[model samples]
Target chain A: MTLLVVHSRLGKHRFEVAKGLSVREALDITALRVRAACGGTGACGACVIHLVGGEVSAPTVAEYMKLGSDERAAGARLACQVRLKGDTEIRLDRPAPPSPWKSIPLENLKPLTHGLPELRAHTLGVAIDLGTTQIRVSLLDRRSGRRIATRRGPNPQGVFGADILNRLEAARANPAHAAELAKLVRTAILRAVRDILARDIGEVKAMLAEIGQVFIVGNTAMLALLGGRGADTLLDPANWQGAIDCRPHDVTPWRAKGALPCAELVMPDPVAGFVGSDLVADLLATGLTEGPAGALLLDIGTNTEIALWDGATLHVTSVAGGPAFEGSGIRHGMAAEPGAIDSVCSVENHYRWRTIGGGAPQGFCGSGLVDAIALLLADGRLKPSGRFASPPGPDGYPLDPNHPNTAITGPDIDAFQRAKAATAAAMSQLLIQAGMTWRELRRLCVCGAFGRTLHLGHAQAIGLLPAVHPGLIELHAEAALAGCEQALLSPGGVQCFDALTAKTKTINLSLLPGYEDRYIEHLRLRPIALTPTTGQRP
Target chain B: MLDRFIKAYNEAVFETDKEAAFTAVNTALAEGIPPEDIVFKIVIPAVEEMMSNITKDPDANLAQHFMTAQIAAEVTEKMLEKFEHPPEIIGRVVIGTAHGDLHSLGKRIVMGCLKALMVEATDLGVNVPAEKFVDEAIARDAQVIAMSAMMVHTATGEDGACKVRQILKERGLEQRFKLIVGGAPYRYDTELYQAVGADSWAPDGVNAARAIINLIQQVKHRDSAQDI
Candidate 1:
């Protein structure tokens, strides 16, 4: 057996493996997080590790293709391709800093005056928004329905991959991997619960004994993975439009494992397909269902979900917007954190940008990318067809001349185009299916972290959003979390969610006839036309 | 004047200038240029040249490639209406994304290019089953079956290209239809096509059109030789 030592920001982790075991596998066994955007196929070159000591097998063809000569010379190698020949020591450098949590707007949530049968004077309840990229938890006092504490952090399951599809593929491929993913998420939630209680209230066990219910909401794939079942069914495209059974066979063991005495663990069923309870929660929090029709809610993320309420029926569909919106798969893209460029504009033939926290520019976020493209289009530097007026250099167009390393490349624009196209096309299709138009939309609720900092005009100019009047648009950053909190505290919350699901009709965009044409038409970097006709430029 | 028109048309298509391209075509029509000649000599050659040039430019954007294919397809359809005699289509092809894959951009681009090249391309849409690929090809009398998969697992998954290849082998229709695959996974690993039992692969949509054309020719030649 060969001993492998790995060092990351978390701490030192050591593992024992047979010869020829790749570094990625060793790290996986140790449960140390590493970025494998291509699921460790060595295609993405994201799993880079520096060799500080010891020897490994020779570099692979994929490494040669992805890594520069200088990088290889500096001892950087793809962990997925190189195997251990003997005892080795390596450093996992450049770990992404954890994104800070957006404060949940408790004021926006409806006050829970009535309690459920399980609620008691000293009892508490937990509400969790299990997002693919981030997880937020809120602890509530069951009697008064007041939030005691809230915690949010990056989802630890991201080590498997950034997108839900990657994690679903990984879970479906191996049973052990599926179990590990479930355990990792469950443990993270338990730790957050413990941390919150330990900080505010004394006696962790006593506080745990006073908990009544733990309410959770997430996408279909996430809920399925957490239960360690129903993931394989999602792999087939035929089941994409049907309701997936995300409820676990049992939660007694999970609760027992965490040593919680909650009376019940409530995970409301995900609506049909990838439309999770999160969107249902968003609708509930925003009151879109109760409003008089012509209201649209778009919760944009890696998997963007759209809900159009056209008076009688609520049409919902999920589009795989990819990771471009969340700042993955770009040349110099990062999450909406400090140092991330969150806004950009052209000033006097030069570009000016601002970071999230007024810090030095690191890379572009989704909003910043939209602003840059929109400004470029207005300046005639970039055409509506997505080509540069003058061909860019090898490094591509630099957003800031001072920070040449932070630039947008040709592939970045392509990624953004595909993402925005998918989103814009889905919006159009949903409207058409509902026999409505953009002008009919009286209320447009944009939900998610990306929409929070997004400039409405810039988003519309780049065709990411429709050319609707700015007055109709509203940005809700923590709608999902607020919905989860409302459900956790209200007496009729479960019934409300059930009612919303009953009315939703999921339109599978892939199966639609003219969806492809609409997608291609919206691929251009211009405002989506107000009309529903194809091949018409705005 | 015809030479100048061809140059202007090629440049317009290369720059994705739709209005300019249509104007150039209309001008050629006014000058007594045959519609068939406009398609065969101007549009087809321009598409071929743009694709060839794209191969040389490392920074070629997909939007440029997509527009080139779209413009070519639009021009060809317009000119085909004015052909003195019905121009003969080279062949037929059935294309789609493999089962469990929802990506349609690559497939759509390939279909556009094939149509511009005078191939009757039938789109099966996305998440197409393996049997569907074979059935559609046989139904349409297509000479080639093309599949696109953007992810690694889908490219090599049991329900994807491998299943199509398996069905073709079982039915002994291997010689009747040629298999071609393209997408990101195939571009990452050139040998992946063989592993998935594909006859050939292309890195992008423009090259994919050229590859499918060659495969169709090979299928036709095989049928003729067998007949002999």
Candidate 2:
């Protein structure tokens, strides 16, 4: 056994683990949560740790790919990739706050259940936004249409693979993994429900007896995994039954039926294969379908769901934005947590940053990265083509040379570029497909937790978000949750969702003519080209 | 003799100067260096080096890779232009990113690399449906279909490579064209290529051309053997 000392804001702690135990394992034993977005595959570089004093195994090739020589020389390594050989004094990188992950604030949620009559006194409704990385649960009072409680947690299925493709691959390799993932989710959901009901078990039980139905909304892969049987159906495109066949199905029981004891676990119909019912929820939350014609809604997530409503038709598409926007793959990156840097400004050739809780900066979240890139582009420190104005030791652009711990490397930039390209290309392709220009759209609704807090100006300056009049952009935070709440409270909510899905013509961005040309064009990280006279953004 | 042309080509490609690259190739050809040697020795190695850099450094400039590919593609066009009679085209290829995958950078790079190899290539682009791949292949009389699926969205449904296999099998077009799957999704699992019912796979642009050529030759050999 060797003693490993870990230094963090939480205070230093010492642990004794058998020789050859990875730093990640040691941290886990200490009950510290480190971001291993790729589930410690070393592909995400998120598990970085600074080795103060220690004898450890040499860095692996995955480490070499993620860390620069300067970083390596400074004793930096991926905690997931490095094993302990002797007593080691190390510092854990930014760790997310302990579980029951923070939920959207009550004020941020807009419940559309207003004006509905009081329901049966004991009836309870659960609205869940089953995201790939995170799950958001909202427990509502059916009678008063009040949101009783909200719960959040890391999706337990992340153990299989953190992203959609990884989970799909896991399911394909072993069909049992699919059922296991679904069971994990069901168990997690049940645990969350217990946690929420734990507050006032007796009172909530009276309310729980009134539990009517659970409304679930998520991307196709997530819902498919949750359904358990659709695992095979999700693996190929030809099997896509389209939105008409994608109606909300009862997920009552797959493992041992009637497990939840709820009326049903119903998933709303998805807009298309890639564009899921979460988007339908987005549309409901934003009321875009009921809004004036020519409105555009973009819900950014692992799979960015885009919906544009012409005067008559609803066109939807999902852009695979990857996990960068969620702060998954970058060094010193985290979700929009308390210590997460949310924005950046340049001063004295150094980064001036703001964190979520105004605490010492731990790492950059999605918005901070967008701001950092915009600032770099504005100052000519980063090229539109993604070349650093000056190389930081032949790898990535240092966020601040003085702050060696905080920097965006080459791999980080590549990931960011790919994400930005996907967003921009999808937006452009949708517009061209609709035969409408950006200016023609009445409103651009930005939905999601990240979208709500994103630095819109900075996002536009970097060409990630299209340049438009600031007045036309709207932020709908936790729209999927809001949409779910609305559906449960409203009369004929399920049918309304189905109707919206049917009207939505999902355009495969890749299949659009000139999509390739536009995608390549947007891949260059530059300011959006605005028509001077018309003030239209592409 | 080929070293001089290789050096010149490297300089031009790294600088992203297409004209200079073309001039270097012309100069080498004018000096009695065979076009085949210029392509096989000079062009291939330069692309291979860029790919190698990209491998070691994930943050390596992908635009540079694309630029190098563009230069190689132009050189291939020029080489064919100089042929006294049109050189025999090795094969026709239809390439794309599987449906639901928005990634096109890798697909574009591969298309450029294939063009440089004197292959008649049509880029069907990203989010391509399986039927579209077959339709384009049939329309173009293509001998190979190359599909690039990103890791996060590599599933068969909603426009993935599995759909390509399903369509090919349904239409009895599986025996018609060689299939190759590549991208970050399948990098760790080559078995996925077989799982998706593809003939072969490559990790990057540099290896894709070689893989295609090998698959094509295998197809020819199998056909010739069956004839006996």
Candidate 3:
């Protein structure tokens, strides 16, 4: 056995592991969190650790390839690549930060003013929006359909992989890995519920007993992974256009595993393919179905889902927008957290920025990246083609002169371009398929954290969103969670979601004609060309 | 004068300036530089240089590679129209994303590079099945079949490149058409191509073009040797 001491932002921890165990494996065995975007393959170089003391195996080829010579000389090595030969001490400088939760506004929700009948009077219900990158949960007072508490955090399953595809591949490759992913998410949800109950109501055990129903909503892949079925079916391209069987064979195990007094744990059926129930929830929250014709709702994340209502029919489709929008894959990208630059603009040739909590800028979130690019374009520092007027140094274009490390690189712009192009192309195709134009798009509802903090003009300036009137655009930060809460409270919520799903004709954009050309055409950082009336109304 | 044209063209392509690249080519043509020289001496070499640079530097700008291929293809198309004698074609290739894979960017880059290198390339688009790939290659009379898979499952799945290899072997067409594979999976594991029964593999679109050209030449040479 070897003694492994890990010093992280979460504090110091010591563990005993067998010889030859990689630091990443040891950390995983101890249930310590380390970001391994490539699932500890050492390909992503995300799990970097500093060797404070003791000896380990020599640097691997992957470590040598991923990390610079200076980094290796300074004792930095990939935790997944370095095996422990003896007692070793390492420091994890960048521990996973806790994702902060924002309570859904009360005014946005329709809470029941009257109490429930005596049988269900004291029972509590929970609503969960299980997203690919983040998970939001709300504890509801079943009596009055009131939200008592809400919690949000990074989905621990992200350690396996950032995108749903990676996790799906991991799950499809190995049953044990799939089981681990399932247990990891379920445990995290239970932990969140327990923590919320402890903080808000006190007497965790009593509150846990009072919880009667847990309603969950997520994308098809997420729901399938959570229920531990339908993942293999989703891997086939043929099944992508049809409704996948995401319902679990049994629900008793979930209730038993959580040891909750809840009589039922309901996860509504996800829509076809990658269009999860979350999108359905977004529609319910925004009331898109009841809206006027030519209304569109976009819930942008790693997997961007767009729904277009053409008065008579609802058209929906999903595009793998990558993780650029949520601030992954960039040089200095991060989620919407404190110290994250959420917005940026230029004031007289100088860049002005604001962080989420008004703290020092740590990194750029999705909206800040958009605004920065738009500002650079406006100032002629960056061309509409996404090239710098003058090539930047190795550190890239610095957003803040004080923080050289916090900047956008060439690859960052490329990543954003692909993401932006895919989103814009999908939107264009949806509009065309519905026989609608930019002028006819009366309402454009943007949902999720990225859309909430996004500057509409900047998003348009960068060709991420359509050039629509300001009044047509509405931002809803927690629309999915709010919809989940609505489903938890209202008896008609499920029916509404079902009707929306039924009316929705999920178009496979890849199979659509001219989608590739449209995608490539929109790759340049310019507003998507608005062509009048390309398709006749069906 | 040719050296100056080459330098100017390479710079414009690397900078992703389409107009500047076209201007450089037109100026060379006006200066009496042969259209073939403009392509063989300028465009092909520019693409090769950019690809070699990308190979050397792990963090190469993908946008630059994409632009280089696009510019080279556009330049080649223009120069072909001005050729005194018909340009000697290298070979034909049928390319597409593997079945169950929707990623087309890598394949598009490869196609553009192939076109610039005077190789006849047919795009089969995304989610292409094994049978479709073989049928298209035969229909197009292509010497090589190229496939791209972005995910691990799609790369190694029953319906991906491996399935194409199986179809080729079953039909005894393995010797006739060479199979080349590339994308995220092959990049992660260099030997994955061998596991999936691919003749060769490349890490990116630029390298994939060079690799396919090599395979096409090999197939043509094998056929000619057999004919003799």
How much lDDT does candidate 2 score? Answer: 0.73
Q: Which ten residues in a row have the lowest lDDT in candidate 1 chain A?
A: A99-108
DockQ for each model: 0.26, 0.12, 0.18
TM-score of chain A of each: 0.78, 0.77, 0.78
Ranking by lDDT: 1, 3, 2
Candidate 2 CAPRI level: incorrect
- Superposed by TM-score, candidate 1 places the C-alpha of residue A515 at a distance from the truth, in angstroms, of 0.6
Clashing pairs in 1: none
Model 1 bad stretches (over 4 Å): A1-118, A257-259, A535-538, B15-20, B30-32, B226-228
Best by DockQ: 1
Q: Scoring model 1 with DockQ, what do you get? A: 0.26
- Output candidate 3 Cα RMSD: 14.0
Q: Give the native contact fraction of candidate 1.
A: 0.44
Better of 1 and 3 by TM-score: 1
Query: What TM value does chain A in model 1 reach?
Result: 0.78
Q: Per-residue lDDT for A475-535 in model 2, tens only?
A: 8778898888888888676876887887788787655556654555566666666542111
